[model samples]
Target chain A: MKKYSDRDSLLIFIVLIFFFILFIKLMYLQIILHVKIDRVVKKMVTKNNIENSKRGDILDIKGNILATSVKQYIIFLDSKIIKDLNKIKMILFKYGIKIKEQKITEFKEKSYIPIAYNVNIDIANKIRSQKLEGVGFDVRYTRHHPEGKFLTHILGITDCCGNGLEGIEKKYNKYLLGSKIVTRMYRDGYGHIIMQDKLVDQSKMCGQNVILSIDRNIQFIAEQELRKAFDKYNAKKAICIIQNPKNGGILAMVSLPDFDFSNRIKNLKILRNSAISDVYEPGSTFKIVTIAAALDMGKIKCSDSFYLENGKLKLGGHIIRDNHKINGTVSLSKIMEISSNIGIIKIAQKLVKKEFYDYIKKFGFHSLTGIDLIGESKGILMNLKYWNHLTLPTISFGQGIAVTPIQMLSAFSIIANDGVFKKPYVVQEIRKVNNKITFNILDNQKLGKRVVSYETAQIIKKLLRNVVESGTGKNAKVNGYSVAGKTGTAQKFDHKTKSYSTKFYTVSFCGMLPVINPKLVILVIIDEPKSNNYYAAAVAAPVFANIAKRTAEYLGIKKDKYEIV
Target chain B: MYKYFLLIILIILSIFIYLWQQNTSIRFAYKVSNLQTKYNKISIENDLLKLKINSLLALEKMYSIADRNGLMRPDGNNVVYLN
Candidate 1:
């Protein structure tokens, strides 16, 4: 009996050892293979919870929000998991959403179903509260331009996906879309967060804010005057750019026939910013380069007299006529004051072709002005090899070459900045979304490159002042400001006749107020006005005067030319 | 008996620590999530107010309002400047 009991005990011991090994193997699978198996199971039940981070804001120098992002929601359908389709449809109907039966069946298997986006929080929360199966909620941010149509061309617009398609918005898109993250959360068959990662700073995902050098008051004044001229003249296009000549800061820039950011674009032509993209003949305003070059090189003197050819000079089978007729020889300064094209062309004839070409390029023409905006055009200048006998004479009077208004403004800015060329920029600082200014223009202290001798710039300024005070630019003078500027009226090129058209003209005026220690440099262009008066003096000068006057008053600029009673 | 007593104490302490850590992490997560919700609300409010301010300061809107109110520009004779 004892032997029989021992045999039974041995069998029982072997069975016990087998059970113990099985238990150890099960524990190993649960602990060691846990993460790998959990991921696979989680894929079936887990969904990514994305935090729709806000895009950065764009503000004026004074921290006035021009462009911002608002919190919104995106409601998507999950037809696969939907329990009560009719009930879900009824709940979403009040929030401007409808799910067609056929459409739901068509995408019945799809886990991710998009229904409506940009829904406000109040409505979104109401829909989310129903907690109906298959209905999902996602946070989204919508871009807002608070100033409406103002600064449209500068602020630009975004695509449906919130990507900046144009202007400053497009330029700083990367910085604005900061660190939007998608996190994994596990839930049961019913959508609920079982386990989730830690909450992060949602604001950190927002893009950095861009602060522009544009002044709201100054931009308003410029836009108001430019719009008035644009409407009154029935002009095809109008552009006005205001710059801080001391530091190459663009204060105000307006291009008319402009589209509103709030409205969908119907015509693509309105998207083109004429100030930096469209090229036009600079007319007599380009004479500054000729005079400055000659004076700088000691090739032409201020007192040097030139025969005016009795107001007309025949060159290369083309007659170049001066609008203001002057008899006999006139001093160089008188030639500039009268804007005698023939006299200036005669002076240009004295310099070598290469020297004249060198000076034209030296004045920031036929090249990008390096402004912060994109799609800048390098104005047309024919290579010296392509320059015919007439090219030099026409170019001397600003007829043959084409130049962008921003480039023209920068050239004038060089003179105002005491012959130093500082690159023009619209962005003044980059800040955090919370209005903390990070990168500042004032802190940069960028040194400017010398473009001309100070003596030459002073001479040109004096001549420009004479033009405004006693010459064609007299209309551009302010009541208590000593302004200096040049007037230009260049005929538009007609492709049909292959010659300059008489009917259409681009009248422009580039100038600055408080000539000595100048505060602002302004450029105004009116393209193809239908009015009887198409002269730069008549069409563009008055606009400059009004904008400068209002801007000076708003900025409280000192009146440097006041007379004592 | 002494060894068995030590083992029981160690196991209980370990289990207690594990439960405490899980409880603390989950509790702090809820707090963080609540704060995030409040922050998002404030940010939305800030943006909406800015939009309102911008509309009020809009140049065209202001001009139209001024015109409607029968405002007149001061003449040169009436205008004064502060030095």
Candidate 2:
């Protein structure tokens, strides 16, 4: 009996040892695999929330903030923590938050609930004053354009992630979107905060700030004058550009029917930057190029004369007529003054089609101005081989081709800058957020290239000055400044009719101040003026005069001659 | 020996305090630099506001303002201009 009992006791001991080993194995697995398995589970269940960085500012030359980002708070609730639901509702009602009891009760089962979004500091302060449990706030940055609708198309706006959607904002998106900061947070088993990371100042991570060449006052004046002209004429659109003739710095550019940057533009057509994006037949404005080409090639002297056909000429199965039909043989100066199509056709007939076409190419037509704006159209220019006899004659009178407004302005700038063609630029400088001026020294200064011969440019300037003083552009004369410019009244082609429309015309004027040594070049275009007087001299030239006068006065440019109102 | 040890301890404490103050000043300088950027932005905004006000009061702008806002001359005789 004793031996049997001893054997049974030993079996019991063995079973007890087996059970102890199982418990020890479970403990080992829990200790060794706990962290790894838990990490995977947390990743699957908990979402990693990302905080978007605030967008950098668009500033004026003087560092005045044109656009900026301000901090706003999103009010949230963890309804599970609300000890008194009715009290919380009452408190929210006082702050104009409108939190319903039913919604709060429903949210009690959830971990978190969003009550209000995008509230400013004042509203946030009021909510915080209540000191209610379960109430929380998450911060976000909202963009504010301080200049209101000023320079709207240029400054542009951003999307939710701070991506520039258009204009300068779109042009320099990579430079303006600052680096985003990422952080991780974890909750304990009870959903209580176990770890938290501090917030980062997004401004520190922001990219370099851009300083535009635009002067705020000049922009204001241009917009004001262009708006007035647009309203007065009841035109479809108006465009004006003010540029520094020295280095191609576009000081001010306005394309009316311009959209306000802050408001959501309902008509997408208004967002189109007509100045650089739209191409038009330059009409008589292209005469500057024709004459310049003729002068450049030494084919005709400024005093040379040609017999103009009596009011009409047949070419390319098309009839060309002068708005003012002068019947006599006119000098080169007279042809320009009268804007005679026959006179230009007579001269253009002497040159080979390739020479004239090459000259057109040299004038920067059918090319992008590379003005640091996106979606620039390099206007349509037929290849030299594509030019027919008719093409040459028609192109001489500023037809059968298209050019952007910016290209035209750059061409004028070349004439104004003593024949040196400078590439137009909008951004003048870039500086870091700190007080250090990046362009403090000489080496950091910006520079440009020369485009034409100073002598040829001077000759062209003299002729253009005559056009303003005693010719077609006489209406564009400023009282004190010797204005040099050309007037254009081009028929806007109707695609459906496949011919120029009688009623639709683009009337334009391009002007340079102090003609002998020009400082500023201003261009104004009024589209489809309703009044019977749709001539460039009457509709567009006056707008140019007002902009030039106001801009000159604002810039403190001294008048070389006696002034008048 | 004990007095020498105490003196050594005092010197180390003084050195630590001096180093700590220097470190704090460097931090303060960094903060000041950050604040100055914000201040500069505000200063520019204030200047812009002042310019806007001045422009609104300028002769030409004021004339337009008066014309638009219905605050024109009480009578034709009340208007005056100096040549």
Candidate 3:
């Protein structure tokens, strides 16, 4: 009986000891480890969701959509529960989606796996309908150009990550790429943004929409005419710009050879916007700069006479000859009308070197035009101290100096704008998602800087008008519009020959309509024309005429001449 | 003693109602979460469709099609001014 009692006591003591150990473990788990366990549970239940803000839309002045973003989905899978991997592959393959078979299978335990990216909405819908248990989708944005291949260089292309890489896309990337948002959402086992709380403002995620001053119709017209000439001449490159003279708004800009932004580009050269990126000798088109400077400085006048030296001027051991020779004495108007190189050289000789350099700077040459485009090239200009005997006369005739297409257009626009230089820009306005103006450039402010007097600009305009009316720019003359312009045919410099190449030429035409009070300024340039005629009057003027005519008609520009009073 | 037994039963009934209400609230929250997800997806789909429509109606595409069909733009002489 004593041994039985002792055994019972021992058993009781062992049972109590086991209960105490269990109680201690319960206390540790419920108190000390409680916070840690709660965190783990929350992490399992909550999803770290990243909602991408939609990139802003690019719209023309008329609210025409040029570029936009569409919601695309990346199809993913949880290989853990993929019942019948072959079945999933079969459905995906039906919709033209090809996925690597071995990758998902190898990572069978991965909760989230990417199957395909940028699956279009139509196919994504078809995929969601399948209701495959483990398959999932994550949303993303794909940049879409509504205008297709048109304005490729202007609107530029976004990379796979929806970041702008060139042109306006790069220039306004910060403004266009809205803020990305991250939300720790409490999702129900399956990962998703729990919208029940409505905590995140999706609208704040969107970048600002850019409203460009570009007129789509005008851009199309310029692109069409420029492309026609480019193909006809088999030119290496071509550029055209249409600007509003009154306010310096760039209405249309076309550069070719251009690439389709929607397609993957192989050659990066096609992405360059040549209108602002490339520089070439203005040739005869640069004569306007000489005239404007001469007239502005009271050094020369339309009525002033210059001895052509029989159309050949011997200066600095180099005999400079004119394209069209005029013997004896000729008026400044005649010099411009005939596009005589000697005549312009004689005029440039009248202005001092310092005066010439100052005028060039005033005309917005040798510096950026601030045209709201990236990669603007400041044309080559020699320092005044480096000017030799031949530099002045040579530069006067649009040789030995370089100017971009946009710079030459601005010079012409100053004359049309009553001698006031307005900074050229393409972006008219930038609005936030809520339609509030963030950056507004479409103000009524005119005359960014006074380049020359109104009287001097008028005299230059008159001479330019005569050049178009009955001069070398006759092909550029639009019917009943009173055009004013200059044509350029510059020899491209050959690095191999260390001089200008005879075979390669850059033909250009920069002009404005209704010279009396111009509204539009248009410029066209063709590089390395392989056609029989490489003259600016032949290759570039006709293109200018065609584009200007179409643009005027589209914009309802009134006929200034041949109207019955 | 019988009254106290009745009171205990009443208390048990009230506790059961309270628990049922809490359960209903949780179920409603789940429904709300699901509805929110569906709404977001639909909105995205709607935006995508709108973008597609705009692309299809782009002027450049229309012009290309018109050119293919031998349609030439009318000259300035043919266009009558309305204003």
Candidate 4:
């Protein structure tokens, strides 16, 4: 202090200057970077949210709900905010929740931690009332199919984020799942957090509620009948489809063993829609298409007759035989009634192989039915270029080719609907949430193409009716209405053995009613029945009869012929 | 003159305080109203979802399906188990 030299004073001034610069820098940070720093700090303290919109409800035609969503809370813990670990543990234990030590240790370093998800409102309220600090709850919407086991393949399911995971849910996910909105907020001096006014328009964002063409009662009936057949025959799988032939509206489509929408599926294979997804050699059931094609081409008249080749006809290396081989010539109508394999082969030979192949293409075989569904299959049909002499003959008798249950039904629908084949659809309309405004009918434009003459269709229907009355399909005959349909017993091909497995059989029956003027067409399929009966008449015919009879009566379609048993 | 100046400053300060309080109360009232509306909306939505769930998962509906189809509860002897 005594040595007051000029240099010393200069040094002290220099130090003061340095100190002033540091002070300026501090002020700059506090004022200039205040907004950014505040944001970072708020991010550290504020609650984060993953936004979601209300999911749409799937409804039957009668306004019955099939699927909808409910808000479920995911309880979490902010490890940093939790003042006492013991307290959090106590609250968790009270709610029957357990926290492993490893989880707690792992999340101890994290600011936010998830403890449990999908807790119901009651438990969420109880947790909220505890008012424990650092405990957070995220309210999210979860999908729930109220009809847990009914229409599982159609209603489909969604993921935790409300994304459609399967079925119609997957097909129309975007239309069914509306838009989600997210907002950030922070507490003020009074602990009331004000929202930033970037209001999202959520009204138009939520998925529009869909109304399906399915009637709940009709679906129930179809499912019940299918299930009874499934259990009675000890069938490995079963499917039933009910449709309004006039507009190609699908009323009920059930496949078993169907999964409960509410339960976690152990095996996903069972979830497949067998009616549209799985293809089988249609067997005798496919004779309908071959006959329809033959009739449409005018290659053979309804009165056309063919010799049965004396019960055994050699076509290439294969021998074709009938179930009830009548060793004589039969009329075209009797050919259908007896299901003569040789008779169909003879008729198929009438068309040039190219014409026969083209007719098969026209009937939508080896092609999708364009139905409103997922996982549709176009069954295998070799092109005319690869057609061998045996190919045409075998295919004529409903073998050496594959077709889905839906394709067969749609083909028959063309005949039942008087030749105008309308594409099948499941969804009917979309409705708004706030108001009762229906948006639009699903695919309002009709896609119809005439595939057969009205006269040929009428003849085919009569021939089918006779099959139900006194032929192989007698089990499918209704009490009051004259039913027309065919029975199919197909042998499934074994991949490893490279031959057909007699142990595995696909039994199916497809039919329409009122013979002259059909209103509905029903198809039932039973796969791998183990009840010691492999015939379609024993396995699938009764199922079709029950579903058709009850369904026709339910629709209040009066019988044309009032006959008592 | 000193006394008059002091009185003017006091009047100005009092007016400013009154305005600030009024603005704060209005903002608080708006927040409460908004929150109340949100709560009401949530309640309505919750009710609607509940009704939909009930209608879809009704026992009568399931029973009708079972009855119409002829499905019955499996007997102990008929039930098969696969590993």
Ten contiguous residues with the weakest lDDT in model 2 chain A: A437-446
lDDT (Cα, tens digit) per residue for candidate 4, span A352-378: 888878878888899888887889999
Candidate 1 local Cα displacement, residue B46, angstroms: 3.5
**Per-residue lDDT for A1-565 in model 3, tens only?**
4656878899999999999999999999999999999999988777676777889989999988889887888888887777777788889999987878687667668988887987877788888999987889877888877778888888988887789889888999999998887866666556553433445656678989999999988998898889999998999999999999888899999999999765778888888899998899989998888888998898886689988888677997889877666667988898988998888888898999999989999999999999898899999999999999999999998999999999999999999999999999999999998899988885644437999999999998999889888899999978757789999999999999999999999999999997878889999999999987789999999999898888888899888887323
Candidate 4 regions exceeding 4 Å error are A1-50, A79-90, A96-113, A184-186, A195-204, A434-447, B1-18, B25-30, B33-45, B48-83
For residues A1-565, write the lDDT of model 2, one tens digit per residue. Answer: 4656878998999999999998888777788888987888787544455766556666676666666666567788886686787787788777788886676677667857878865766677778887889888877666666556677777777776567888888887776677776755444456543333443454576656667888877888899889998999899988998899877788898988887766667888787889899988888888777777777777877778888777888876878787776777888877877788888888887777778877777767887777887768989888888777678887887788888898888888888888766777777766667744454212322464445466778888888888887899988988777899989899999999998899899999998998867889999999898989889999999899888987876665667776554
Model number with the top DockQ: 3
Index of the highest-TM-score prediction: 3
**TM-score ranking, high to low:** 3, 1, 4, 2
Q: Point out where model 3 deviates above 4 Å.
A: A1-23, A76-85, A100-115, A131-136, A189-198, A563-565, B1-21, B68-70
Give the local distance difference test score of model 1.
Answer: 0.85
Docking level of model 1: acceptable
**lDDT tens readout by residue for model 1, A1-565:** 4656878898999999999899888888899888988888878767777665677888888878888888777788876788887888887887779867776677768987878877777787777787778888876678887667788888888886678888898877776666657877655456545555655666766789898999987898899899999999999999999999988999999999899776779998788888899999999899988888888888888778999988888887888888877788988878877889998898888877898999888888998888888778999999998888988888988998999999999989989988998889999999886767777876553788898999999999999999988888988988778899999999999999999999999999999988998899999999998899889999999999999988887777887777323
Least accurate 10 contiguous residues by lDDT in model 1 chain A: A191-200
DockQ for each model:
0.45, 0.05, 0.50, 0.13
Better of 2 and 3 by lDDT: 3
Instruction: Give TM-scores for every candidate, taking all chains together and pairing residue i with residue i.
Output: 0.87, 0.77, 0.91, 0.86
Per-residue lDDT tens digits of candidate 3, residues B1-83?
99999999999999999999987866876777777667667867777777778788877788879999999999666788887
What is the two-chain DockQ of model 4?
A: 0.13
- Report, for all candidates in order, the number of backbone clashes: 1, 3, 0, 5
